[model samples]
Target: MRNMKVFFFFLLFFSLCVEFSRGQKEITEVNVGVVTDVGTSYSDVAMLCINMSLADFYSSRPQFQTRLVVNIGDSRNDVLGAAAAALELIKIKKVKAILGPWTSMQAHFLIEIGQKSQVPIVSYSATSPFLTSLRSPYFFRATYEDSSQVNAIKAIIKLFGWREVVPVYIDNTFGEGIMPRLTDALQEINVRIPYRSVIALNATDHVISMELLKMMTNPTRVFIVHMYSTLASRFFIKAKEIGLMKPGYV
Candidate 1:
């Protein structure tokens, strides 16, 4: 009886040690990989917080040991440059995942490389709906695509009880890709586009503004500006100057 009692005590102690070791192992191992676009600063709110949030997900979740390898590229929104940057990170650094190439143009090239290399690339603000179905198994996005935003715009129009909607979309992929969907959704809501304009990203002068103002004439009261940050700011400022938008709207 004495020998049996000692054996049972030893077994219990061994089990406790094994459990403790397993728990310790669980607490220490985690990694994640990130890639930020050159258009954004490392300390910039959009780039830093967005990438950190993904890394934080694995760190907080018990399922992963999230060790991260982040690489910032100097593409300045160039597609080929972004692709090359991604290739170097994946091939040399062996990053398991990437989260960037912040523009549709950049993502366009990177997606092909990512598909070929078997690495996953997740984008935050790429906004082009066309990219949604392109090599989709590897590409993921946290935000709604341009199409979804267009749907949202349609819903907003309905909520505001606006009859005529004039869409002022940029001529880029981000804008063109979504305009059709927005138009369809608005049509379903019995809304019509009395006016529309597709302007390039860089046309800052009143050439486009005069055209937009003519479209904004008494018929269409509400205007939806579908432009990137820089262009949006420029358009808003010019629109305000031309009395198209009120100070509050600005």
Candidate 2:
């Protein structure tokens, strides 16, 4: 009887262990790649948001068998750097999806890579119309194309009764891609573009100031400025310094 009791106890323990092991699910890991220039505030905020979202998703769904893992790579705000980061993520990390290269210029090459590798490339802030996702099914744009805003700008011009306007934009893929749409939109409303000022992405304060001075000499008070936030901030600072922000200026 003692032997039988001991054997029953051992069998029960073994059964419970096997049942517990069966109940615990194996974690399925899905690796996601984040490629961005961490030096910029935009990328920094993106990283924070991505982390928060991942944390919230996992915390709210404890029963989820699949876990998403994020691997971040800095593109260093250049084409070559972006390619390198993407290559590392695709080859070394074997990420399922890649998020960002920030600008359309950077996305141009990365999109091609993603297509070849059959990985999705997601961009939240790249707004250049030239980088069309239609060309590459793997490319996804989270933000609206820059051309979409041209109609709103045209409406504003019509409401204000501005006869002519000047567009001051960064001289890059982002800025150039919107020009044709903007011109067409403005022309439809009989708005004339007296001049289009192109500011280089790496232009210095002095260069921006000079450009503003040239614009001030012109009679057009209503100016449309389009660029990344970092360059836009500098432009406004110089505008304020030169009294271009005074009354009667738009």
RMSD (Å) per prediction: 12.2, 13.1
User: Candidate 1 — worst ten consecutive residues by lDDT sum?
Assistant: 1-10
Flag regions of model 2 displaced more than 4 Å: 1-24
Candidate 1 Cα deviation (angstroms), residue 80 = 2.7
Put down candidate 1 lDDT per residue, 1-250, tens digits, no spaces: 3223222322333344345455354433222244445545532655555445445544555453322334665564566777778888787776656666677878878788888888777776677887876856877665667775666677778897888867887887877777777878989989988767777877857766776577656566778888788788887777777777763231
lDDT of 2: 0.82
- List the candidates' TM-scores in order: 0.73, 0.86
lDDT of 2 by residue, 1-250 (tens): 3223222322333344345455558866667788999778877777777776656656775666566677988899888999899999999999978888788888998999999999888877678998983499988777678888988899889998999999999998888989888999999999999888999999999999999999999999999998988899999999999989999899
Query: Per model, how many backbone clashes are there?
Result: 9, 0
